[model samples]
Target: MKGVDLLDLKKIVVFLPGRLLPADCRETKFHVSATVGFIHIVAAHDYLGILDKLRVPDDVRLYFEYRELVLPQLREAGVVVEEPDIMVAFLSEMDLPEPGSIEKLRAFVQDVGGFDLSYIMRDLQSHIVNPERSTDYYRIMEEFARVPRSIWREFKRRLVVSLEASKAGTPRRPFRFAFPMTDCTFMVASMDPDWPVIGEDGIRMRTNAVELFTQAAKYDLKTRIGVGLLISKVGDHFLLDWCLIDEPWSANAKLEDLLSTPLFGPARERVVDSYHFRGDNAEPGT
Candidate 1:
């Protein structure tokens, strides 16, 4: 597999495990990235598992309540994780004017030279509402703003111990996937094998179902892929609400079977072969 591209790596770390590492660790070992990946997986699993229990046979209030309760914990975890990465990045990349310079710290936060504390806090705030629309947001923001320096102090202590262990040549385990499996699934689904054609009136229109998979030369090399999209229609426009992409094996066997049915099977074959209908302006049949 290709090494996880830097943009994707940054995207993965930005809110969750990304918040955990120091900014300086951007070039850390793939194993460290893998540990972050595992943390992300575990967090997702915990969130989803709780969501299932709170679902309670379609109680929407419980769902929102769950969100309100859990959002803070996740946000705090991200904030804590981000501090170390920011501290490391700052130490390695920039020159500090003074040991306790408030001006420099303010400039760093404002310019987003490192940690991105403001962005993370804003993102966390966006998920929950005050309902009565009072000063809760400001209060929470104030609470978080007061702690970075202290957080960094403790983090530095831990980092020293970690670095000492590293110097002693501790064996590191390898991770199987370069990027998360979900990332691979989404990337594969986003690949477009065909471009749009222009109509006589000069509007560009799509002519086929978007191709989702490509055949490999060897059978063993072929990837089994499946994706399900939940789309909503509002007025004259269609909006994609959610997407789930995964391998078409075991738990997703039903999805795999759905793709292999006569309707989709022929459409997929036509796409792979670049087959065009007989009529000049023919649209594909449903």
Candidate 2:
């Protein structure tokens, strides 16, 4: 399905946080005349694994239990209730090169388009000015100037490898929302909590985000589900960002806020019907 047009699908499944629907509803399915969200091309293994993991009755129940039980404890202890450090798990599992190993760093740098000091500095500047900028920005900048370029590049590459490994590794408790549809259950996996839906300016979507999702669609199509994207203004063009796929717990609230925006007014009209199902205990509502 090369160049698969999202409009071609007669019916599409939209996975939304269950909290958005009626309290008693456990499953729902409906139709929309126009696209409701960004079309992201995700790997089958990634998404299907989430679906399979979620469908297990024990896992599903345990997920809710963990949210209620462990998350608050973590928050009380000043630990963020987000995805675990799968990278640390990867490091434990494999004998990867140390961050200070220059030989391994050189190979990694070449593999990742090589090191460009100018580009790195520009990226650092962008981060420093970002509204949600990192607190360690000043320290990082100070260290960048003090350290040799090669050493700095090596450290950055190590972070990149760690992040990539984290993504590939299975989360001890994956973040996801399940919508048990009539025919099948559709799952929406959460992206990193740190990812900004809008740019630092607060209105536009980040250019890198647009490029990432668009490029992701080009690979495998077997696991491809229909696309649902959020439109954001980028310079003169409106770009797409994956929707309802942000942090699972807050996605519904985010979607609600987005729909109220002037840019999303058209999407509201296109959403024809929304249904809520309560298994066989009650009638589904439209």
Candidate 3:
């Protein structure tokens, strides 16, 4: 840590995709996290309302500046070894497919305000072990299948607001995964599908991506969600760098629990403070 320059390490920011917890859970909150180099630097939004994209670059730029200012605090806390060279942010949102681009779109709606797949898996596991309910898999499957339709309906409702507003003399911008907030980007890097199988020697090895993709494709069920970083170079230049592309949903554990932690407000506050972000930054009808 003494000789390492924090600026030389990669800075990563993660904006977790918003999702609903199990029906039994009591809270619904959006989540985010950041890492400078290997350090889980101090910090940590249910941001469902509209965001002003015109103000985002400036706001994010200030966030980077504030983090730079606070680098020493993070270092003193021993969370970072060196100053991160690249600054990254991860963001995700529900997006409508581009006209005639259904194949390119991810069709599976994320679980929101309903039963999570995790819950379904648990139920399935219980049924598998309970002989009396082993044959009820189809019923469980049917119940699980309802989540996507629910998610899609919610998204479609949001979409209608955007469309209606646009028709009423207020044009809305398309969202981007990297920027405007989830689908406007032109390039989507492919995801790696290899699973990590623990070997006999106590090491984990990755499954082959090609094989995984091929298998999923056979069922027409191929989609990749990943941990990606939005890297910023000089002023106003940003790039989306995929770190763990095609990571399986099960591999994403921290994201699910992020909002449950105490660090959320402070983390977001530092960034918001940097830009003096106000709810009024959004234009009327935005």
Candidate 4:
């Protein structure tokens, strides 16, 4: 029988489970779509490729939502748009913590007020920099679900998965796809030949999709895409500093465009890109 062999380690895709997505997802600037919020969290943890390999399924009919603003810029020039999010599991490297031995995090948290999240994040990121404390920190996150059990259970789930995943140095967004955007006529794809039973393919799908969009820009596809950061507005301008997917592509000219649009403003709150980058204030556009 011509089937995916269990002996094939190179054929599986490592992916991030949707469960890792927080229930406290914030509102997107201008509410372009779910994608604005999606990009931010994925940008953190270097795209969190939990596994290493995958053989793409024969073909799958996929529906992707890109920043509408960029679609026109890429399509007008006939450039194919693709954003591949992979459910990866076999990374050769992983982001392991440096093993800080301070047992009490209260000291760390106390140094920077939790209420002053920006200060806490910038000064006390070490509190959750490792596997041991990462989940511990989040389970207790003030910003997490009001219910304690919800946060704790989810934290445990993520920790277990993180331990089992392939530890490759996960790459940040902005990679280019070996394949240009193509219309496969929307076919059925294997969840990715790697980790056939898991969500590795899902992670890979996102990674690939991101690459395709970035390439669209190199092709001189001019359009500004705004990845809705967890943080919203501060004063007259929202802190459009932190970039989730190194390259934010969209229909606007800059991040500021969202502010001028019907749905966004500098006074709104900023959303975090997952647990990555705790707090940030306004900065000149990147």
Cα shift from native, residue 126, model 1 (Å): 20
lDDT of 3 at 99: 25
Q: lDDT of candidate 1?
A: 0.27
**Candidate 3 C-alpha lDDT tens digits along 156-237:** 3433443344334343332112111221111111222132223532111122322222222211211243221111122232
**What value of lDDT does candidate 3 attain over all alpha carbons?**
0.27
What TM-score should be assigned to candidate 3? 0.17
* Cα-based lDDT for every prediction: 0.27, 0.29, 0.27, 0.24
List, residue by residue over 9-86, the lDDT tens digit for candidate 4: 121122353555553331111122353232222222322321111111111101112222333444356543212211
Residue ranges of candidate 1 with Cα displaced over 4 Å:
1-98, 109-238, 248-286
Which numbered prediction scores highest in lDDT against the true structure?
2
Worst 10 residues of 1 by lDDT: 265-274
What lDDT tens digits, residue by residue, belong to model 1 across residues 1-286?
1366323222212223356666545332112244443222223433453333222222223233333334345454543222222222232232221233333323222211222234323443332222143344454343333233322223233333333333443322110111122222111111121322234321111111211221110111223432211112223432221112223333345445544543221111111111112231421231
Q: Which of candidates 1 and 4 reaches a greater lDDT?
A: 1
Model 4 ranges off by over 4 Å: 1-124, 127-140, 166-286
Q: Candidate 4: TM-score?
A: 0.15
As for lDDT, the candidate ahead, 2 or 3, is 2
